[model samples]
Target chain A: MASVVGEEVSNKQVIFKDYFTGFPKESDMYLTTSTIKLKVPEGSNGVLLKNLYLSCDPVMRILMQRVVPKGFSNYTPGSPINGYGVAKVLDSGHPDFKAGDLVWGSARWEEYSLITATEGLRKITHSDVPLSYYTGLLGMPGMTAYAGFHEVCSPKKGEYVFVSAASGAVGQLVGQFAKLLGCYVVGSAGSKEKVDLLKNKFGFDDAFNYKEEHDLDAALKRYFPEGIDIYFENVGGETLDAVLLNMRDHGRIAVCGMISQYNLDQPEGVKNLMCLIYKRIHMTGFTVRDYYHLYPKFLDTVLPYIKEGKIAYVEDIAEGPESGPAALVGLFSGRNIGKQVVVIARE
Target chain B: MASVVGEEVSNKQVIFKDYFTGFPKESDMYLTTSTIKLKVPEGSNGVLLKNLYLSCDPVMRILMQRVVPKGFSNYTPGSPINGYGVAKVLDSGHPDFKAGDLVWGSARWEEYSLITATEGLRKITHSDVPLSYYTGLLGMPGMTAYAGFHEVCSPKKGEYVFVSAASGAVGQLVGQFAKLLGCYVVGSAGSKEKVDLLKNKFGFDDAFNYKEEHDLDAALKRYFPEGIDIYFENVGGETLDAVLLNMRDHGRIAVCGMISQYNLDQPEGVKNLMCLIYKRIHMTGFTVRDYYHLYPKFLDTVLPYIKEGKIAYVEDIAEGPESGPAALVGLFSGRNIGKQVVVIARE
Candidate 1:
């Protein structure tokens, strides 16, 4: 595989500049040029990948912050940024993958990435669908929604499901999945456009623009008259507090992410947690990494929905590696309405 | 069953004069004498009870306040304050109960209570144990501890357990139960006296006085150097926030009560909840009432421990029904050392 070396070419990469405190800005990361051998080093046990599509997620903000929380690693200042991405294998020293194999997993944000940690990479078996779907609908975010909804929320037919940031990457899929399970799904988003997308396009039973609602509790009560049984929590803070008050007995809250609290120096104080006791609510937080074992099952369940046109996905794609900083930062300000993706190259 | 009858007698009752806010005072309740015929109505099915022991629990404060939370009914004004109590059935029109039967369930804080809702009542089977034990060790609080620690927390042998307000009725039992499962148990109490009782009497592995510790997170870190496997949340607010930070991956938090938040106008906001997402923690809140259906199973498991002196119960007995208000209020101020019980009549 090392024999396919081309002439020395400049490989563009996004570098983490410094540790961030509050909200991360575009300047927090800078572009740099580097040279790659275009091949896996001799006797090296790793895969050489040509990056195609990069995923811009909220967890990136936490990785950019000064002190990373426990069980999570921070991006090094001088190194290239790493995230979930779609890539084509150019060279492979590992037996599982070979050249020309398109895969999705953790990768460095550069034209070419030498992935030493290649165990998480999944080989693309179905090419009939758009390859970029591996970065979202078939990738980390996909598995997240699949596992978070089915295993975490433990949804039952006709149960009331409420999702926050419902038009975002993971939340949108959760709403659709809940609807498919025969749940009465309601979603809350920041804008009318997102809310409309949730109801009209994604098949949510109802949707509301949280920004317009002065009283979140009242808005929730209006949407969920009997109270919510399953809450797919993507945005935390005020939304979480309100949901706590409106959850039904034996309710389940799958805390997938707290996108609202990531940029803040101090996360908002949730005041209605006592409601958890009275309602006998179960709230759990999880990461997609732990659920990758179900990736095969997830694909089997979700692939038919995609091929049959039963599931709809919206991606806000930015072209070229130069657009990486803006594409990532736009997530914090809700500048991107749906799943934020950055395309580096085509096949 | 309504055969017993007696001449009219002046029944001493504690009546709720007004709805309370913030902290309840003795003035919120006043003594009233009412004449009773000491017999059930000829056509109606209700029990006439002579109250023996009343359990003063923290949740009573929430019921006494103006606004009741969902899933919990509030005590009405101009009515006797009701709580879990042990009583002697003077007369019963229900087929399940009869005159001279000993029962414990929802009963009024008065000398004589005409119990219309007797479905929650459990007839005493084990007369060998002290009858007052029904209010603390063998009744609501006992079932609360058993179900909370076993069913909700799912304690495994050699696991690390943390109990907040550990010398109180439910907390004391939780610590002992955790120890019985061969888990390493630590407890936090308000006073050094209670702390000592947790370690020396309740068989806790370690105990700390939360009042003496300025930083709860630091205190928790010192006690749980490795991490907490399960947290029995009897006291919420800051303790909950700290426990969130120190929890191990997949830790369980059984929220039985939030005594610290019951008296506050606005419950304190929990700030470190993001740990839940990072550690993949599970936090659930429940009540003993929901688990009461397992009462026979619980008694079968816990009764032998009591008989063998493996479980110790400490009670702060208020001499008479006149001491009810002070005994109940003392819980918020940390006056009572253990389970607060008001004795009405012995036997």
Candidate 2:
């Protein structure tokens, strides 16, 4: 490929139009095109990235709301929204990154982004796996499952583990990780296909379609007869209330995200929280950003599993930058089967 | 005192008439008498106790309900309800206890109790402090404050600590313990008197009457401008929901008790729990029984403070065995200003 120096290329970007209160729609964000110089600015330690794959995460919904929840920064209206993504370094003024280096971390949902904050950017060393995996299974969601389960839930062999939103990005990996740890893992998804994927593809001991279950408490009782020792909470609300009653003594709940409640104007009230005292349960919330220091150790542990075909990943890819809004909005409606990703440019 | 072995004496007792729902009343229990030989039966390890001071705890109310919560054994109807008390060993078949040894542990709400389950009993080593303190400051509540604060909350020096129900048995001590660790401690109580006790007696940095504060979230923000580093949760419901919003990143909540929700048929829904994830908080529920192994170490630390007047304990004493029902029921209504105790017989 010939270098196109000082040339302006049309950069399509997703922009936040307005803050949302309840469920977000495609109109909440607008797609706009502008031209960008495909080169780093002079004398700046910034990396110019041609965004390849953008991750559509549930936490982005929280950032889109008018009042950003505590400990989170909101996306500015009219500015390009940024999230975890895989990008190729088109130009670099930074010491670590150079041209042609494939990197992933935080990137704008646009064709090109001049990233001044490149401290957290991880340089991709291996391309044996799909590059898109850097946006899901090998990226933030994977680390979330790894850290939330091992560090927060503290699973022991033969312990009963239950995960909500089990077919989603983090839940799928958590169920698999729990199974690998010799735990009895059960997962709950919204659709039958996702449920089947959980039990069949992810090797979960059991899986249920939560949408079909009218009585969540009874469903939990049927699955976790002895009681759940670890609950990887991804979809909070009634599921949490049911799981509370079914938790064993000293049960651990690793609250990764509450996707079910994210878009609701008022999140459902958890009524059985008193069970936390009765059962001596520990409920902790965590983020992958805190566990980034252990990325190498995490890779060492998970990479072998991937190579051995012991670990499986499922991705729901949206074809182009134009599909970004619908793909991101699809998460709140439980429309995505697995990890939702928007592909801007394959290279 | 002479031993009256063969004589049948009237053993006045507070008997649970039936299981209760919602708030328990004094009428739920009735006074009765039964003849006892006042001697330990042959070939039995049961220790006979002359009940001196009975500790009125919120947990007893749970045991009195028809459906008992998990991890706790229910008190039987038509039987003497048992609780923690200071007692004198009248007759003992157990090796550790002898006649006239002052002890504090599980005892029936009666003048005399035949304790078959004496394993949890602790022989009182210090009579220099008030024997009544055994039921509150020196017994279960003291150990609860010690373990829940240091072990569960993991307090750091100069941390901003908030305690709910701060004039109550465990809360009073938790506030003091946080202060001893060089933390700035604020406390909330239901009454102005209790609030005064928290600030004037317990030495809390600040105290508020939660009853007067219509907006709990605003009150918390007023107290914790920067954010709360630790919350010693004794009262749950609205206070918990408010504190969740005021917590700093990685703040811990040691759930020692939820006195506010114990009597409710349906516990209050904590709406702001999503804040747990937003702030990466750790909310853990703990009971003192699990930390009893550290009792001796706890005493070594707390006893000095009590003896030196560094720790002040307030007790609301109900005179005689006849007053047992009212003192026990007073806990639910927040009528008792401090540690509620019924003095059966001082011996």
Candidate 3:
């Protein structure tokens, strides 16, 4: 690879158009080509990255709304969206990185990105596994499942565990982790195929298609006759309310994301919070930012499972920059079967 | 003081009429006269009690409803209601009690009756403190505040603590406990008089009348500019919804009882639960039943505060057994200022 420093290259990018109410649609974003200098500027801790694989996550919709969390910088209307991705460093002024080092963390939805905030970026150490694992099972989502389940949920062996959005990025790993711990794990997902994946591929004790259930409370009761001891919450609103009613005494709910409420003008009211007190349930909300300090420890534990064929990962990849917008939109509609991803470039 | 254990006495009782929806009313229960032998049954673990003071609690309304918890028996339509009371034991079949023992725990809302469940009962140790305090500050409500705040909320020194229904038996004590622990304590009550008590009497840093606030969220923001660190959630529904919006990151909520939701046919949906995730909050629910094991520890801590004139206790006593129904009903409408106690006999 010859030095392409200061060379202007055509950067194909997925651009957020504007924040809109209701469920996100494909037209909310557009793909465009622009020129970018493939070099880090002088006297700056910045890394210029060639974005390889971009992730389509539920949080994308949360950032798309007019109301983002305090101090969180959402996507700028004209600029390319920032998300988790596997990138190859083309040039670097940061002491932590150099040219040809593979990394994963926060990156823009563009062919080439000048990443000023290099704090979130981690250098990819192991390459024996598929590089795409850095986008899902080994990245933010993996850390989320690890921290939320082991730390927040405080799961024990033989305890009954329930997971919502069970076939999605964070949910799949959580169910598997719970099962691997000798817990009786049950998961609820959108479609029949995803439910099948949860039961057959993920080794969950049972899994149900939430979309087909008329009575969520009854559905939960049927799966968890003894009541749920741990709940990994992703889908919120009705599912959360139903889960509350079925939680056993001293249950723990780890709130990762609420995909069901993200698109609504007004999120649904949770009526079953009274259950929190009656059951002495501890409902905790957390993010990967708080737990990333344990990344090294997380890798040490999860890698052996990956090597021994103990941990299974599923990814729904949409090839090319053109498919990015639709891939992101499909999350709200439950169109993606597993961890949704978009490939800007394979290598 | 001669034994009159075998004598039949007229037992004036407050009988629950029937289960009804919406807010409880005085008409829902009626005063009636019945007869009972003033002695424990032969070989049975029963305590014959002369009920002195009956507590008017919000949970009374809960038991009056048809939707009681599993294995929990609700108030029978024609039976004298069971509640917390300070009583003089006339006779005992259990080894824990003897004749002339002053005790507090579960008692029927009647002048003289036989109590079968003695597990919740405790022999009142200090006769110097008002026996009525056992029905309020020294008994269930006092234990409730102690456990919910110190144990459930996990309060740290200098943390911002907010108490809803701040002048009530539990809330007043919680606010005072937080202040005594070097925390910035604020409380919201239903009346201006109650608000005054929270500040001047209970030693809260500040107090507000929640009834006057048109926007509960703005009201909380005005009081807690830094945002609430621990919320003593007594009034649920809208107050809880507003508190959720104003909570600081990593806030803890201790749910003691949701007084606001108990009266409603349908509980208000808490819409701001998304805050639970955004702020990494821990919302926990608890009951006095599970925490009563720490009763001895609680009495040790709270008694010194009472002896030093440090923990101020205020009780609103309704004279005579006839006032029982009205005093209990007053809780829903915020008609009672402090701990509502109905006295059958002062001594």
Candidate 4:
């Protein structure tokens, strides 16, 4: 393709209208075409990039709301929304990055973005595998699962493990990692299709459709008869309470996320927390950002597994930046089967 | 005192009348006098002990209720209630103990008890300090504070620490321990008297009465202007939710007990748990039993501190075995200033 000199290039960007109050709607986001110069600005230590693929995560919805004392920074209205994405460098002024370098980290949801080389951003030198894998299976979600399980859960061989949202991005990797450690892995998903994937595809010991299981306590009892040694908690609420009742002595719960209670006016109460006293369970919550230093170690451990088919990954790609808003919001409704990613521009 | 031959002695026993529904009442525990021969059965390994002192803890209430599937054995109704106490051995068949030997461990709440030589029991050879210290300052609660802070919380010097129920048995030790580690310690109590004791007696950096503070979040903000690094959680519920908002990056919460919610039909919902996702806080629950290996090390570390007057301990001693029921129930009502103990037959 010939470069159009002196011509303003039109880039499609997703912008948040205002802070969200309740469940977000598609109308809350506006996809607008904006003009950007093809070159990096002079004296600016910034990298200009064309986004290839964007990750659609549940946390984006939390960033859209205004919470007291500010739980975290929210996306500014009228500004292009930002999250983790894989991009191709168009132009750069930083010494570490250059034009044509493939980088993956936090970036704006647009065809083009001007981002400073932040501490989190890293150049993707090895793309022997699919580049889109950086958005889910090989990137943030993968690191989340890896760090949460190995570092937080600290699973030993023969431990019984339970995972919630087991077919989703982080949960899928956690289930696989637990199985690799010789653990008896059981997972819960919203639908039978996802449940089947957990068992047949992901190689989990057992899978249950949480929607179909009327009695959560009974379901946990049936699945974890001896009791769960480790629980990778994604969906917290009654499931946590039920898991509490079935935790073995010295059990560990790695709280990655509480997706079920995120959007509720009032999160559900946990009635069996007193069980933590008797069972001496360790229920801990952690995030991927704090464990980013282990990313290199994580890649070294996981990349070989991916290449040799020792580890499997599944992605549900939504084409075009226009579908980004819907793709992100669809997470809450259980619409995405695996790691949800939006393909902005394929290599 | 001369041994009365062929004469049966009257043993005053505190018995559980039935399963308690909610908060236990004195009526629930019936004091009955029964005759015993004051002799150990032949070939039996049980030790017959005259109970000198009994420690009353909040966990006893949970034991009074019918057994739930919490993995541990619950106290049977119409049986003698048992917990940590300092005792004098009246007679013994166990090789490790003999008559007149001082022992501190789990024993029944009666004038006399026939206890088997269990693994948890230990003979108290060092009487350099008061024997009652075995029930509180040097025993289970002390070890709880040590393990929860050092092993679970992993405190660093100059880190900000918050202890709930600061004037109570475990909380006082936690606050003092955090201070001794060069951390800024703040605590919360139920009344003004307890708050004063926390600041004056326990050497806490700052203390507040949770009952007086209408807004717990505001109270936490007032104390922890930056953020809390470690939260020694004794009273959970709203206090936990408040602390969640004020927790710094990588903060740790050691969940010891949730006394505030013990009597509630439903546990309180925690809203700011999502903060864990953003801040990457590690909130973990632990019981001291799992860390018993550290007891000898704990004694080495704490005994010297006590002797040097670096650590101070307070106790509320009730006069007789008949007062044991009221003293145990008083824990729920915040009626005791410090560790509640009943003096049955002090050596």
lDDT of 3 by residue, A1-347 (tens): 34387898888999999988998999999999999898887887899998889998888888887779875777889988888999999899998899999999998998899999899799999988988889899999999999999999999999999999999999999999999899999999988999899989999999999889999999999999999999999989999999999999999999999989998888899998888878889999988889988999999999999999999999999998899999999999999988899998776
> Per-residue CA lDDT of candidate 2, range A103-193, in tens?
9999898988889999869999878889999998899999999999999998899999999999999999999999999999999998999
Candidate rank order under DockQ: 1, 3, 2, 4
Tens digits of per-residue lDDT, candidate 4, A70-122, equal 44578899988888999887778888888888989998999887787555578
Give the runs in model 2 whose Cα sits over 4 Å from its true position.
Answer: A1-3, B1-3
Candidate 3 displacement at residue B145 in angstroms? 0.2
Considering only chain B, what TM-score does candidate 2 achieve? 0.97
Residue A145's lDDT in candidate 3: 96
Question: In lDDT terms, how accurate is model 2?
Answer: 0.91
Which residue pairs clash in candidate 3?
A: none
> Taking the candidates in order, what DockQ does each have?
0.87, 0.75, 0.80, 0.56
Write down the DockQ of candidate 3.
0.80
Worst 10 residues of 3 chain B by lDDT: B1-10
**What's the true lDDT of residue B210 in model 4?**
91
TM-score for all models, in order of appearance:
0.98, 0.98, 0.98, 0.96
| Candidate 1 vs candidate 2, lDDT winner | 2
Model 2: lDDT of residue A163: 94
Fraction of the real A/B interface contacts present in each candidate? 0.93, 0.73, 0.81, 0.60
